[model samples]
Target: MNFANRIRRAGIRVPPPARLVAGLALLALTGSLLLMLPGIGTARPLRLNEAVFTAVSALSVTGLTVIAPGRDLTVFGQIVLLALIQVGGVGFMVLAVLVYRLIGRQMSLEDRMALRDSLGLLSLTEIVVLTRRVFKVVLLIELIGAILLWLHWRTLLPLSEWDAMRYALFHAVSAFCNAGFDLFTGLPQFPDGVPNDGVTLTIFAILIVIGGLGIPVVADLINWPRSRTLSLHTRLTLFIVLWLNLTGALSMFVAETLTAGTLHAAPVGQRFGLSLFQVISARTAGFAGFPNLEALSPGAHLTLIGLMFVGSAPASMGGGITTGTFLVMLISMWSYVRGFPAARAMGRTISQETVRRAGAVLTVSLVVVITATYLIAISHSDIAFLEALFEVVSAFATCGLSLGITGDLTLFGQVVIMLVMFWGRLGALTIVAALAMPRRKTLVNYPDAQILIG
Candidate 1:
């Protein structure tokens, strides 16, 4: 038989999830190669490991880096990073589909299927229309944010007009992508590590919040009147997002009330602002208003660790197990304690499959974080356990916040970090789906049994 007929006879086919993993892998590889070019970095070409780490970080929109892009890379390299953030934040499938539509090419059956799978759409109907709408909404929000930032920053900083505009657009996109990369520390006229100006913080806060809300939630918001109803996904995403933000800010404020060289030294208004910014950044955007992260109290660090673990909403640029997964698990526990057979929220029952999948995602993610933490600990034995844990969680959650050891790690530790960033971006479910064999239904049905459980 020919190759196609032989494969058909053997019953082999690649699933959409697998295709996503493959596509991302190819993109990351290409990004690394491009970064290694001589024109991108300092006098010398970028090293392989450093280039790979940056590529994965950018494509994942994670914002972690070994080499400082600002001091170590030329403006051209930074622009490439921005482009990666844009494409990665919107997702590979969305960009591919857009290119196809712009060229007046019809989407193939497989393309439609992959787009549906990647975008987390409820149905395949009107996928193209939805894609365009999402793209437009994202661009509109980003453009407006960039303009607002430029207007505010132009008079505050002493940089040239073009330079100030560059910072504005760079940070606006970085914040919107929840990719914590910044030009503040590396650029001229800002000897301080990050911009502490209130307007800047406020703008970043807004962008990070909107970006972390995920595309589906944004669409629900745009079509509110016509739809006249919200999906359970949107409802839970919003409720959890608000709760996490509030709780994170309050907990950090209280925890660092007396700590020195950090929140304690700041004015009351600025203290709250810093707390708000840190919590929001920890929510998945890792920009720093307070640069000396090592100065925070252990309690404050613990609070941040919890927030980072919870992470942002599903289908957003931010990572971790996601707030949706965390809330589902919490609700499931509450229902069980109240003696309910099923978890119910807003007078609706959560399906068993959701609970099961949430459990799997959480469990797999825990294993990933713990395993990576162990590797980082052994690799960097001189660092504190909490610091190592913090770095690993930051990388695995794709939050990009660090305890200041990102550059100090050895090559092996850096590789471990890159792997965690890649893992965090693809996520537990996608990774599992990509690896697991497809199931084939059997003729016979198995009997069900009950067993004692925790």
Candidate 2:
């Protein structure tokens, strides 16, 4: 038998969940090993915790880091890390499957099902086409983003042609992946004590918005003509994202303006730019123009924590409960308030199964964050409860903005955050589905009883 046939035969006995879990585990392991190579960084073999943490962060497309990227790692090392982020963000297996299809290789039924699950597609064939479209979409967006960024950077930095090209490419990939790794050490605040100008902040914001919007939504928008109406998924994502962006900007503007003594004083234009940048960065992109997280008011910090919890859209480069899940819960709440029998959105009733899944995702994500916060607190009591909670939520949402506590995290704290990042990226449900065994149903049906729920 051919390799595909042999794999098929083996899969006949192996459950789909096992295959999914095995695939993700294998990818994570391979990504970790590759990132650990000596060629990847100048730092001596990384501490076990550091290596694992970096691996998880990159694989999750989270920008959290214990070490500075440009200073800590050589060019070669940065490239390897970037590659991991790209694959992890797009999904390694999904890309591989797309490659096979492009070359005219027939995908086995098992493989199709696995791809469907991984990409969050409704059907196998549709997923195959969607995967191809996603690949094209990513390439187009990254290419255009890189060019625009390069044009903007060329005006700011006086550098050799090659160096400028490298910087542009690196930041472009990082921004597009929603991975907040920055070569510029001093952020929000410029290295030479210069303020972040409007142009740089605006470009970065656009990049973050594009990256955080999920691939499916991007695909739908790209093909909008045929389906003049946007899908519920797309509509909800846009609405939630706009609301959050505007609210976050306004909140930061007021908070920063009021506490101008705490944060560095800037002109009106620069202050607005800084506020917008920091707010967007907190949501999903960890890129910060300013390093003074301690300067923000307690209210701003709390506001950031809330935004991180909401996170980016589903199947996007960023992570969180996902806008879709959040919207579903909102609709469910609205229905209850209106005395409706079912949760509805955009004139369509959400299936009971979808509502249940959203509830499960939210519940599990909250539990993970709370448990991690408590654990971190036990290990590092010096850190305030709210700070610990913020850090945990940042990890769980894959939003890497820290309260200036990353490098100071205890080894135990690092491990806890690493687990959160892993869980966030793989998703609570995906992990649960992977762990669950296949079930066989019997012919007999048991009577159902209603339980009181508050």
Candidate 3:
């Protein structure tokens, strides 16, 4: 039997979750091996830990790095990182399906299922359509972002027009992928200086938001006229995203103003803008113009930790427990408090299965984050507990923002964070499912037991 027939006959199927895990593992391992090569960059061959860490970050699109992007890596290295970002952001399995379609090959049922899971589609047909639409939207958004950035950066870099174009394209793709990789050696600001400019910051913010919105919601908005209604997923995603943005912005603004002694004494407008940008970026976007994490007030740091924990929406390039999962938990809590039979949102009742899945995801995420934070603390006692916790959340959320301590981590700590990033991107559910064995169900019902609750 051929490959397809063999895949069918094994009684073992590659579910979407399995495919995603396998694809990401393969990509990450391959990228790590490539980065280990000598002479690939002007800098020395990355240490094994660094290589693996970078690979995991790129494959997870987390953007956490021990070395600066433009300065440490050569053009070739940057290209490899960029390719990994694109693959990781779009998902390797979805890209395979797209390639199959482009070559006039029909997707198998298994393939369709994989695509559906990767894109969080409810049906195989919808998955196929979503794949096409996602490609178009990503390309259009990235292209537009690149043009705008290029216009802003034309005279800033001491390079030819062609070189400036390349920089613009690179940063644009990085932002839209939520990769957080930048060609600039330091901060992401105007060409002339480190001063935060409205044009650059606004463009980057737009790119990050578009990338984090999740493709399904974008597709719904694009097709709104004909559909006339958004799906439950889209509605929930929008609600959570908007609410988080508003609250996060306000909280950060307040914290920054109250703690202004620790913050650089900037104009109120600039401080507010920085607070907003950092708040949004903390939610899995990973773009940081400033590296002064140590300078932020305790309150601002705590606020960021909360934002990173919540992270981005489901099926988006970015990761975390996900906004949807958090929203589900919140709704479930509200329902329990109100004595409702089931959780509901936006006039629609959420299924018990979804609620259960959300709980499982959140539980596993918490376990991983807490456990990893503890491990890192054991390995690097010099780092503060709060900073370690922040780093753990950042890694697990695939939000690369650090408390100025990532580079100071030991090998064991780096490895732990790498695993966290991988788990975050692939999702706790996908990882758990991949390891679980398939068992045939028996026609038996177990006795129910009630437990006492607090």
Candidate 4:
């Protein structure tokens, strides 16, 4: 038999989840090797671990890094990093399907399923339409952002026109992709290592917020003008996202103000501005308004951690338990306590399967974070428990905010962080489901039994 028939005879099949994980892993490996190639690094060749870590971070769109990208990598290397960020932010399968459509090639059933899973859609009905929409929308937003940033930065920063354009494009993509690769470090104007200017920070925040709103939600929003109605999912996602951003900004401002910490040194209005930017950044964008995160009070740290843990919306350029999952768990718990039979939101009852899956995701994520924290704490004995936990949560959430401990991680600790980043990117439920064996339905039904109460 030929290759295809031979594989069919052998009953070889890779499930969609396996394909996703495998595809991303393969891309990461290729990226790492590319990063290690000559001319990719500035002075000397990059070490294996550094290459691997950077590659994974880029592909996962996680901003944690052992080495500084702008300082250590050449222009070619930065381009590769930018490409990975774009691909990772918009699912690779999305771009693949778009290409296939452009080439007038038909996609197989397997391709459709993979795309569906990648976009986190429940149905495959609008796979092609959504793919095209995502590509067009992403590019348009990035283009507008780049133009605005270029116009503003050219006047403000001391750089050549070409350098200004390049920086604008890079920051625009990074912000929209929620990839926190920045070249402003060590700059004379940006002593804080990030943009403190109102216009630049506002542009970055807007891009980050839109990017994290999820592809499906964006599509729904764009179509809402014509349809004149919003789906329950879109409504709930918007509400919760707005609520979280406001709450996080307010809480961080209060905490830091109370302790006279990082925000205390800033002007009254500027303190809230810093807090708002960092709060927005905490949701999977790693941009910091100030250089020293360690100077923040314990309350501020906790607020950031909580925001990171409950990241952006589902199927967005972010990683965490996700807003949908977090909201589901909260609603489920509140319903149970109120003696309600069903979890309700926005006048709709969420299915039991969704509630169960949310619980599973939360449990698995907690286990991963707690276990990783324990390992990092033990492996890097010099790191304090809170710092260790922050690092673990940041990795697991793929938020990339650090207390200056990323470079200090030992090999073992780095490995743990890498695995957590991978897990966060692929999602706990996706990985668990992919690794599970095929399920066989049983005709027999067992009688319901009482379980112990919490």
TM-score, each model?
A: 0.95, 0.91, 0.94, 0.96
lDDT of 2 at 31: 67
Model 1 steric clash total: 0
Shift in Å, residue 351, candidate 4: 0.7
Best by lDDT: 4
Pairs in clash, predicted candidate 2: 40-77, 187-289, 187-290, 188-289, 188-290, 189-289
lDDT per residue for candidate 3 within 1-454, as digits (tens), equals 6665777788766766787787788888899899888765565988777888898998898988887767677778888888888888878876886788889988887778777777766766567767787787898999999899888878755667976787888878888888876777442443422224678878888888888988778878888999799888888888888888878877877876776634447777777777788887889778774546667778888888888888888888788888989999999999989999999877889899999999999888899999999999888979999999989999998988887788998888888999999998988888998888888999999999999989
Model 4 agreement with the true structure over 260-364: per-residue lDDT tens digits: 897787888898888988988898888887779998999999999999999889988898999999999988988889998999877799999999999999999
Q: What tens-digit string does per-residue lDDT give for candidate 1 at 205-275?
A: 99999999887788888889898999988998999999888888888888788566377877877888789
Q: Alpha carbon lDDT of residue 111, candidate 1?
A: 69
lDDT of 2 by residue, 316-361 (tens): 8888898788889999999989998999977899999999999999
Candidate 1, superposed: residue stretches over 4 Å from native: 1-12, 258-261, 443-453
Output the better candidate (3/4) by lDDT: 4
Residue pairs clashing, model 3: none
lDDT of 4 at 336: 85
- Selected candidate, larger TM-score, 2 vs 3: 3
After superposition on all CA atoms, what RMSD does each candidate show versus the true structure? 2.7, 2.8, 2.4, 1.8
Report lDDT (Cα) of residue 332, candidate 1.
Answer: 98
